[model samples]
Each structure stands twice: as structure tokens, then as C-alpha cells.
Target chain A: MNTCKRIRQHLELADFMAEDSFSLAIEQHLATCAECRRFQSEMLQLKHLLKTEQRVSAPADFELRLQIQIRRVRAEQRTVWLPWIPTPALSALAVVVVCTVVLSVYTSIPGPTGISQDPTAAHKPTPNSGPVQLVQPKPLKPEPAEGLSLVMAATGSTEPQNRPSPRSNRQHDLNPDKVLVLVRDQNNTENFVTVPTVIFGAQPVINTNAPRTEPADDAQHIF
Target chain B: MSIALSYGIELNLERTIPIESASDHELVAATKEGDELAFQEIVRRYRNPITNFVFRMLNDYDRAVELAQETFLRIYANSGRYEATFSFSTYIYRIATNLAISELRQRKRRQLFSIFTPWKTAPESPEDEQMLDLPDTRPLQDEDLIDRERRLALSKAIKTLPEKYRAALVLRDVEGISYENIAQILDISEGTVKSRINRARNMLREKLQAYL
Candidate 1:
């Protein structure tokens, strides 16, 4: 590096001249060049003046004042909302309130009420009722020039019986009409079980003596 | 003494921890956990340096102290959110710098407005002249007076520089912060910090050449 350029760089970074190796070369240049030497001296003096400026101390009551201020701020934050809930707790409370409002709105809407909501009310038998009977599969009658015909009995005991079978009358003690039937296709055996279609808000009472269908035990009840 | 006595138990606990040996980030972490003693320690450590920095920037003693207190308040308020992404010193200094810059901008706006509206003036009376003359009772040694004048002149020269340069110079020369750290505090590159500091020092030197 040339003497003038090197000395100029040294003057700009004179604060680190004491520790840097470039200081030696700068020193040699300053020893010979009077202008660069004066520049270096002036820069050092400026640095010294800047460093010697006294630091102002905080007032004596600073710590106490700060502590009090912090306490006041914390107190204000705590009481920011009514009932003084902290931020985390307040967030959780907000979530709970929103969920409750949503649930109440959902449940209070006018719709078909599930039977399980009031099982006792739904189980009471109506006054106009007769024993519910499950019709037995009659022997398949072969039509002339046609295959055997299997007849399906209609859902309630309102259908007329062809023959008053004694077994049909004996199993009429249990409420068989209320039992929901779920057909499980096992081994492709087409055992047809009819389920009574219940209209919402209409209570149909059927006093049944038939045993409850066992298949109803495995069925998923919507109610 | 009042503060020490008021928080005596906390001070005792703080003493047990040896605050001088703790790192800035460690103290900040403790403060984050709601340790009042650690917060007090942090205030005690940086309060004076921040006061001086703000004093140089604002050139008002009362405002400097007030702003320094505010700086600590900010640190305490934000302790929970303070991540050690940079050094604690850098973080605190950045807060102080921003506050000082904002105050200066407000002062400038006020000055601009005052220029358009004439300032209110009270009539000068004989009593006012007499009051002005009845002074010089306080004793000041020659060396101390000269030192005070020199310091005042230096401070004025520093204030003349642009705000960015002044901040960089104060942090580097007066506070002895490294260029890299000053860069972090100012959110600038180290090269920019170095250039600002050098320019600031050279400008001050040029302005105060007669005194030198």
C-alpha cells in the first residue's frame, strides 16, 4: 500500500491502531510524513475526548420507581377486563362461552325430537290398541302353470289373517311392533322382517304379546 | 437506600445469585419467569448507561432519566416475548434508540409548528433584569468549569450530526459497543455501522477544531 492511502485508512480506524499489525506500517509512514502524523494525532485526541465523556447515572429513586411502575402495569393488565381474568384464562373462558352458545342454539331449534329424550312418554300405550301379532310363513302354494308364491304380511295387526294360527296368538304378550329390525345378510338367507315406519310426532300404540326380536339386540338404534 | 430497604428481601436473594456474574440473557429469562429480583438487577445494570445514551441524544437531563425509566419498563413489559435471537444488550439498546428517535421526531414537529405560530412573550421589566444579574453565587473551580464547557460543546457537536450517525457514534465510542453489536441494535450491516461512526466522529472533530 502507498504511504498516503495507508495512512488515511489508519486514521479512519485509529481506534484499533493499538492492537492491529497494520499499526506498525502506519507508524513508519507517520514517522516520515508530517501531515499524516498530525492527522493520526488529531484522530487519537478525538477518540480520547469521545471516550472520556462521563456517563450520567440514573436518579437515586429509579429502582423503586421502576418497581412501582411495573407493579402498576401488571395490576392494570390483570384488571383489563371485567372480573379480572388473566390472558390465558380469559382465552379459555371465551372458548367455553362460544361453545355453550353454539350448543344452546343448536339444541333449542324446533325439529323432530329423538324418542330417547323422553323414553317414558313414548312407552305409554294408547287407548285404542289391540294385541300385535307376527304372522307365520304359510306353506308355499303352487299357482297353476307358475312357480311357488311367498306372501309377506303387512307391518301391523291391521291386516286380516287367513287362518287364526294358535302359535301366532300365543306369542302376542311381548311388544313386538316396537322392536326395530336390522337385517343381517348371513349366508344369503333372505329372511324378510318388516319394520313399521314411524311418523315423527305421531305416537302409535300397539300392545304386543310377542317376544322381542333377538335381531333388535344387535341393531344400532338411531334414537 | 430507600429502594434497597424497600426490597430488602429481594435484594438479599439477588445477592445470593451474584447478579454481576449472570449473563444478560439469563437475567432476562429469570425476569420472564416473574422473578422481581432479576428484573431489578437488569434495571440496576443498564439504567445508567441508558440514561447517558438518552441524555446525549435528547440533551435534556430530566427527559433522559424519564426515557431511561421507560426503557426499563418496556423491557419488563416485553420480557415474556423476548427471545434470545440477539444479545440482551442489543435488544435493550435497540428499544432505547427507537424511543429516543421518536422523541426527537416529536420535538421537530413541535418546532415546525411553533415557527408558523408566534411564541408568547412576556414584557421584560426591571425586576427581570435584576434577577438575571443576581447570580454567580455558586462556586466552581476553573478546571471543572472548563471541563463542563468542553463537554457541553462536544455534546452540541454530536447533536448536530444526523440521528443515525449520532446513535452509531454514541453506541460505539461513548458506550464502547462493538461495531457488530451496534449493527444488530440498529438493524443495519456492520459496514454501515462503521461508516456512520467514522463519519460522526469526523464531523464532530471538524466542528470542534477550535477547541481541539
Candidate 2:
């Protein structure tokens, strides 16, 4: 009769068996009923066996080894973000950007202007000239004017000195003495900074009031 | 000056390792502050019992040790995320037990493949071919044999149950944890834990009736 009642409370048996007063109540009930006594003995045996087996000893060095592993894993996690923070590829990209910017600035400087001109040359060829040529000049006599001409040549490209003179039209109306005087004034050494224009093939009319005639195309080539 | 010195001493004591004096919440708080020593203290304290529990559940020594280590590593990595909302013991046990269950599932899946092979192709049954097979290897000592058979019977019986029942039994009867903690670790209610443990125990009792 007691076993029938106790069997229904098997879930609460572990708790009741833990207390001395409740244990005495169970003991008194088991003593009065044989079936309840058998159930109590079985419960006791099973509990004893489980408790005895519960004390499983872990191997030595378990804690030390576990500590080492935990530390190693956490340290590894610290490095995980390092790869994510600034990868090798990102550093390489930064270097590429810096070098490109520096290279662009270095190449962007404008070099010294007009440093490529030469003296004693004929018509200066334009940058896009194709198969163009100028007639060769009769070599100038070894004269003191050559020194002054070279001094002007040192200024810049010969293209500037080859431009036609604005005063050449007026020179045709001047008398011979006046023309000579004008030529002397035009060739003033102090004015070597401005190279006198060369007349290639024809002499101009005198300055004694003669009318100006149109020069032939061949003579115009002196320009 | 003397009061300040005493205050400094008190502060140092508060910061020092508390051994068993500290609660799991305090240790978890320290670990969140990057205190590796505090985390190591937790591992040192719980390693043996937890390892023992996992080993019993898996029945594999190497696998239990591996899972035990992985449990603490997860604990340390996720310290900041730990809500003091639940017992730390339950959280770590859940990790260790879940890993063991996965391993068990994988092993069972492999064993299932061998089930289709015909029985005659397997080794001869000892009872059926006793004359041709080796002599009976059953032990003669009743007491020693009963204990051995009890262990074998229990292990076999536990394996036959579903993973949820096995977990509840291992946590309650095997590891001796409270039903509340078992429920927390298994993510079930206390009532469910009690029902599963009872069912597991009844199944085990039925299987081991001959030995009893």
C-alpha cells in the first residue's frame, strides 16, 4: 500500500530522501510495507552507484594545458583583426597612390623656355615643317659685325631675328648719302639686340625722291 | 595618510584573484575587461568537473578534452556578450554538450552505413556457434561482473535514447546538476527536464533489469 503511494512521488523522492525527518517518514512507511521497502532499497542502490561513479578524476595537466590553449586562441583572435584592419593589399595600394602623385608633380614642371635656339642658321623650321628649305647665303666676310650678331643670337631662337624690318619701305625714298647714313644708323652696335633684316637678292631704290617699284617674287625671298 | 594606505590595500584585495570566493558574474565581468588571468581562474576551477561530465557523455576521452577546451575559448571570446541573465555554468556546459552531441551524430551516421551488411557476413555469434567459436569468455566473479555489466548496460541504454533525453539524463543523474540548470543548458523548461530524465531513467531501468 505504501509502495503504491510512494511510486507516484518518485520525482520528489531524491529531495525527500535528502532530509532526515522526511527520510524517517519514508523509512517508517517502508518498514510497514514490504513492496515499499523493496522500492526504497532499489532507489538507495541506484543513488549510491551513481554518486560513487560521479567522482571522475581528470588527467594531470588538464588545467595548465587548457589555460595555454585559451591564451593562444585569444592571442590568435587579436591578430585576426590585424589582417582586417590594414591588409598587405591596402598598404600596397597606398604606396601606389603616393608614388603616382609624386610622379605627376615631378613631370608637371615646365622646363627653361627657348633654350633650343641656334645662331648662324637660315629660316627657322616651324615645329610641323615638312620638306621645307631656304636658299643658302653667300658666307659673310669675316667681319667685326659677326661678333655682334652672335651676341644677339645668344638671346633666344633665331625665329625672332628673321622677322621683316618695318623701316625697309621708307629706305627706298632716301638719297644715297642719306641711305648710307640710315644704314649706318641701322647697324649701330648698341642696337645689336635687334638684328638688322637681311636683304637677300635686290637693292632698294635710292632716297633722292624715286618712285617705289614692286620687287619681283624672287627678290622678296630675302624675307 | 594611514587611512589612504588602508584604502589602497582594500582596493588591491578587491582586484586580486578571489579563488572560490568570487561569483561567476564577477569573474565574467573581469574577463570582459580583458583580464586573461581572471578567465584562466574560471577555467582552472571548472575544468575537472566539466571535462569529467563531457567525457562521460561522449564516452571518448580525446573528444571530451577537445570540446572542454573549445568551451572555455568560446567563453573567453564571448565574455562581453555574456548577459548575467543566466548561469555561466549552464552556458559553458551547453557549448560542451552541443559539441559532443554533434560528434555523436556524425559517429552514428557512419555506423548506420554498416547496418545494411548481411548478418551472416559478420563475425559468428558466440551462442549459435559455441563449438566452433572460442570458449565462453563470461567472467565467473558475480560481484565484479555485475559492476562491469552495469556500466556497459547503462552506456548502451543511454545511446539508444534520443539526444534530448540523453542530455537531460547525463545532466541530472550523471553530472548531478540541478534540474533548473539542466533546463537552462538544454534550453527547456524545468518540467521538461524532469519528464525527460524520468523517461531516460525508466528506459535504463528496463534495459538493466537482468543485471539488477
Across B1-212, the per-residue lDDT of candidate 1 in tens digits comes to 12221112344553334655667887887778777777888987899999999998887889998899899999998898899999999999999999999998898898688667756364257543532342233445697786676676687778768899999998988899998899999999988988888788778878766556
Per-model tally of clashing residue pairs = 7, 3
- Model 2 segments more than 4 A misplaced: A1-6, A9-40, A75-79, A82-223, B1-17, B117-120, B123-142
lDDT of 1 at B25: 83
For model 2, residues B133-179, the per-residue Cα lDDT tens digits are 33234655787777876665556566667778888888887688998
Model 1 chain B: lowest-lDDT 10 consecutive positions: B1-10
Task: Give the chain B TM-score for each candidate.
Answer: 0.79, 0.78
What's the lDDT for residue B10 in model 2? 33
lDDT of 2 by residue, A1-223 (tens): 5565764366243632642545555666656777656555555555555566644555687767777887787688788866544477889988999999999976765333212223222234334321211122122233444322222121122122222232322222211111111111113322212233333533342232322232121122222
Error of 1 at A102 (Å): 7.7
Which window of ten consecutive residues has the lowest lDDT sum in model 2 chain B? B1-10
- Error at B39, model 2, angstroms: 1.8
